[model samples]
Target chain A: MLTAIAIVIIGVLLFLANMFMDNYQLRILNLSGIYIILSLSMILINGFLGLFSLGHAGFMAIGAYTVALLTTPPMAKQMNYYLDPIVPWLAETEWSFLPAILLGGVLAAIAGFLIGAPVLRLRDDYLAIATLGFAEIIRIVFTNLQSVTNGSLGLKGLPEIEIEIPLPLIGFTLNLSACIWIAAIITILFMVRLVNGSYGKAFKAIREDEIAAEAMGINVFKHKLLAFVIASFFAGVGGAFLGNIMGTVDPLMFRFLLTYNIVLIVVFGGIGSLTGGVLAAIVITAAMELLRFLDSSFDMGPIAVSGIPGLRMVVFSLLLMFIIIFKPRGIMGVREFSWQWLIELPQSIKNSSFGRKKLRKDVSK
Target chain B: MSLLRTENMTMRFGGVVAVSDLNVHLDKNEIIGLIGPNGAGKTTAFNMISGVYKPTVGKIILGKEEVQGGQTVTVEKDITGMKPSAITKLGIARTFQNIRLFKELSVLENVVIANHLRLESNWVSSVVRTPDYTKKETAMYDKSMALLEKVGLAELKDEKSYSLPYGMQRRLEIARALATKPHILLLDEPAAGMNPQESDELMRFIGKIRDEFDLSILMIEHHMQLVMGICERIYVLDYGITIAEGNPYEIQNNPKVIEAYLGVDD
Candidate 1:
């Protein structure tokens, strides 16, 4: 009941914000929502199934290209397909944004099934690096399919996702934030349901011990495959959303670094947790954008650092290293945020405050 | 009628034979023991029977079931070399020589996941949490708690498997196997790290599990007291061949059994 109430509150706040917030703020919001969706998918594969797959970028590429191919206007297709005409059927075809996006997810799922069948046979670091190879394979395939994907020139001018809402005497228009936020919420709810189910337990069992899980009558390979395919499906969805939000996509975007962004999110969250992933995605995305000053010639009154092209990356890397060394398990560490946790806050605060008072008294004496 | 029978089953690793020409029979409600010293073929035989390995020669007869249209499915023609999960679905469950509980999961989760082998719902229904699905999950939850109670781990259902005391962890593993509702339970050294007192407790626990679950039992043990105390039938193995097979008293007195396995010190 509280969860339902909290969701409603969030929805109302977002609805109100749609009326007041500027496009710039909304774009960052949309970007964070996309990050949340991508990270949730990462949690399913890496956290629950313990697969440590790095194929998100490749799967996203499949999805983005799918949406791009299906939804790009006829004129845009002609312009982008300068080298070789877009495949005859594709050149003439067009689809609405939502259906095209979902189809993109479906195509990515098919890719996952194909890749997972062969690669899940590997284990540990081999599986991790092998899945990264699958992602590269996706990019390479998209690049070479000149007639189908318009080679490396990429696609642009994706149709904006728009919806109108009318109140009693007022009306508002939905923008990218609407789509991204709605998608993130849907992804979160789906993941929460999945991780609390029998299949989720089965995935965890496979993670815990493949041999023991098999001996217990759980088909380890089947569960692992389920995680892979489902995670890839949502990864494709996230990719489509991101491409639409950015209004452009190229093969270059789906590189190893694209996957590394999600890897950082999952690690900054905790392994085997959903809420941690969502929260970490939001915090990490916002922090990355906020820290943009580090890349430019900005200086504090007390400290000056300027014109070092790679300095921001160095600082961020050090911060991440610090977190890893000190905390080790990352934030939230295998636990999740819950409504009941609200009850524990007062007690924890009281305990800390009581300890502080005692310390202060001892120091004064 | 035999609940399980292996006929001249053989397994070889490259050129070396691990379990050669092994024959064993188990009837319902009987406790059987497989005993051998270090490097002997006891575990290998268990591996073959439990579908961890496809026997190089011979057959593992797991079940005899009448199919639709009155066809009979026998192990000679089927069920051998199947996936371990399929073998487990054939009403066979096993525990590891080293305790291999889902260490990160809670005790209840461990037992509940095992019972999920019998789950009829698909992933979609589980995700949707439909009425039928939640009903099945609740029933499994209650049943898991009950099984944990039987194993004396009821109060510790929410504790992680790795945090449990060693003896409790072993018992927890058995409880997990029982959740699969097996007709036969194969235990790989149920008392491996137990003290003498703990082994005595384990002997009682094993007997209790067999009687209460109505399960036939097969165990590999270097623990003689456990083997001599409970097992009705004993098969002794050495270097991939059966050295002796008989009632415990006969096997205890056999010169070959003593020479091969029983005389070894812990």
Candidate 2:
């Protein structure tokens, strides 16, 4: 019951913020929500299944291009495809944002199934390399599919997602960021339910020890494939949301760097902790935005450091290195945030200080 | 009639014959021991029976069911070369030579995972948390708790499995195997690191579980006292060859068994 109320309050706060925040701030918020979905998906594959998959950018590209192709207006399609002219059927076709987004996820899942069948068999570093290769292959494929993806020129003028609250007294409108937030919340809830189930245990079992999990009657390959496909589906959904929010997409947008950013979120969060991932996603996205000034020329009181083209990324890389050295398990480790922890916090604090003082007094006695 | 029988089971790893022409039979509720020195292929036999390694040449049959015509028949399925999980589903559960509990998981989770094989609900119902899935999960939870209690680990059900004491970790692994609801239990070196006194306690514990769970057990143990104390029959292997198969007394008096353990008389 407490959780239900907390969710409602958070939901209301986000809705209110949507109404008040400027467009740029809302864009960053939407981007954070997208990152939350992406990071959660990465956690499923990399953390839970113990598969170090680096092909998320590929899946996201599939999703983004799928949504772009399906939802872009015919006029925009004509303009984007001026050199190559999109396939005749795609040029005439259009779909609403929801179905297009879901289709994107479905296509990505299908791709996951096909790719996972071959590569999920590989272990550890080999799997990572294979998946990374697949991502590059996907990006290259999208680049060359001139009639389908409009070559490197990319797809532009995609529709924005806007929803109006259907209430009698207050008809409030939700823009793209609010829609993305809703999607992220749905993703979070879905993931929480999934990880709490027996399948989740099985995934963890696989992660802990694949041989033992198989001995205990879990079909390891099947479960690994299941996790991979599900992660790919969500990656696709996040990608669709990203394209919709940006109002355009290109093959270049879905690069290895895109996947690396998602990985950064997953690592900064505790790998197996959903709450940690969600919190890290928002914090990291906001931090990245806040640190944007670092990328530009700034006078640091006494010394003026000329703007380094990728100074923001350098700072993040240093932060990641620090995290790896000092806190290998990240913020929360494998443990999740719970109400029980909150309830025990005060008592634990008292025990720490008071118990120490009492011990000192006893020693004096 | 034997509950499980192996026919001419042989496993050769390239140039080395790990277990050669081995035949074993396990009856219902029988406790058998596979005792051998290091590298003697005792674990190889267990691996074959548990479907971890497929015999290069062999047939492993399980279950002797009485058909409608009053004819006794072996289950007719040769489980050789089957996947480990499928064999586990067919009512064969085994513990590792070293304790292989899901160490990071809670004690209850370690047991509950074994029950996953019998779960009727799939991932779809799990996502939506349908009533059927919830009911199954509740039942699994209750069953796992009961199993933990029977194994004397109920109080520590919420503790991480690796946090348990060494002896308790062994017991928890047994509890995990038992949760699979297997008719036959294969234990690999259950008494490996225990002292004499602890092994004695483990002997009694093993006998108690055998009767309580109505299981046929095949164990690979380096500890003779526990094996001789509990096992009804023993098979001794040396260098992938069966040297002796008999009751404890017959094996104690056998010269071949002695030579296998002690080197052939100077």
Candidate 3:
């Protein structure tokens, strides 16, 4: 009940902010939300499941391309100039934004299934190398798929989707930023539900000890595949949103750097904790943006360390190294934020309920 | 009829024959002791029975079902070579000679994972954290806690299994094996490093759980006092073969048993 009230309160606040917040701030919010989804997906595969998959960006590429191919208007001659010829059927058909995004996710999931089958059999470090190889393979394929993906030239001129909220009292319009926030919340809730579920426990069991998990009758490979596929699906969706928000898709955008960034987010958040992942994603994303101001030389009275171009990267790397050395498990370790932490409200409610139950039993006696 | 029976079970590691021509039968609800010197192949036999190693040649029968854990064997009905997980699902659970608890996981989590074999929740239901999944999870926790209580490690339920003391670690291993709800429990050197007091306590504890759980236990123990105190029947092995099999007292007095434990006199 408190959660419901909190959600309502947050929703009202967001609505008010939506009315007054500048377009640039809203866009930043949307970008943060997309990063959260990507980070959460990373946590699912690497953090909770104990699979080091460095091919998340590959899945994202697949989703972004799929969405671009389906949603881009083929009839517009200007938009088609830099693009390669689309297959006749896809060119003729018109798909909505949501379904196109979902289709991209499905394609990514299929790709994940194919890669996970043989690769998940390998242990730890080998698994990491195999997944890294897979990402490289996907990136190379995407870069060379000149006929379908337009090779390195990339896809352009996507439809700008403007979502509208039909609210009572004060009606509001939702743009791309709003959609990203909605998607992020949905991803967060989906992950929370998943980790709290049986499959999540199975994944954690595999993480704890694969041999023991297998001995206990868990088909280790099957559970790992499930986590891999699900994580890829969400990553693909996040990728589609990212491409749409950027208004273009490029093979170069989905690179090893992106995969590494997601890894850093998950690690910074604390492995195996969804709440930690989100918190870390937001903090990291905002920090990176905030640090951009460092590019302008600060005149601190005497010493001016002229706007160092690579300063942000250096500082970020140092922070990561520090965190790893001091607290390798990350912020929350393997623990999630449970409602049990909110003690006062639940305790009061339980006490009143118990008192009422006792009175009822006495009256009956 | 014997609940579990192994006929001429043999295991070879390349040139070395670890266990050879070993025949053993375990009746339901019986405590059987397997004793041998350091390299006596007692654990080798346990490994074969528990599906850790496939016997090079042997027939293993669990209840009415006969399956091979070591190597491919031609059976009357089919060619059967079951995997360790499959064998475990066939109602055999085991612990390692060296404690092999999932070190990073909590004690409760360890038991919960073991109980996963019997969980009926499908992947979809589990991923959704549905009411059914929660119910099953709660039941699993309750069952695991009960098992922990039986093994006197209920206080360490939230502690990491590896962090427990050596004696408590051994008990936790038993608790974890029991969590699998196996019909037959295999303990590989359950009291390997324990002092006299701890070993005696473990022996008593094993007996209490055997009767309470109505489980058939096959234990590999070097501690003669502990083994002889509880085991109804004991099998003595030497140089990769079973040399003596009888009641604990009978086996204790056997010439071959003395030869195996202490070198034979000229």
Best model per DockQ: 1
Worst 10 residues of 3 chain A by lDDT: A76-85
Measured with C-alpha atoms, the lDDT of residue A332 in candidate 1 is 74
What is candidate 1's TM-score against the reference?
0.94
Task: Residues A262-315, candidate 2: write the lDDT tens digits.
Answer: 989999997888989999999999999999999899999999989888999999
lDDT of 1 by residue, A112-180 (tens): 999999999999899998999889988998888888987787887777765456676788766767777
Name the candidate that leads on lDDT.
Answer: 2
Predicted complex 3: DockQ: 0.44
CAPRI quality of model 3: acceptable
The local distance difference test score of model 3 is 0.82
RMSD of each: 3.2, 2.7, 7.4
Instruction: Give the candidates in order of DockQ, highest first.
Output: 1, 2, 3
Q: Candidate 3's residue-wise lDDT over A187-282, tens digit each?
A: 887888787665676778888777667666677888899899999999999999888888888889988888888888888989888989988888
Question: Considering just chain B, what TM-score does every model have?
Answer: 0.93, 0.96, 0.91
| Number of the predicted model whose TM-score against the real structure is largest | 2
What residue pairs are clashing in model 2?
none
lDDT of each: 0.87, 0.90, 0.82
**Quality class of the docking in candidate 2, CAPRI style:** high
Descending-TM-score candidate ranking: 2, 1, 3
For model 1 chain B, where is the 10-residue window of minimal lDDT?
B71-80
Worst 10 residues of 3 chain B by lDDT: B72-81
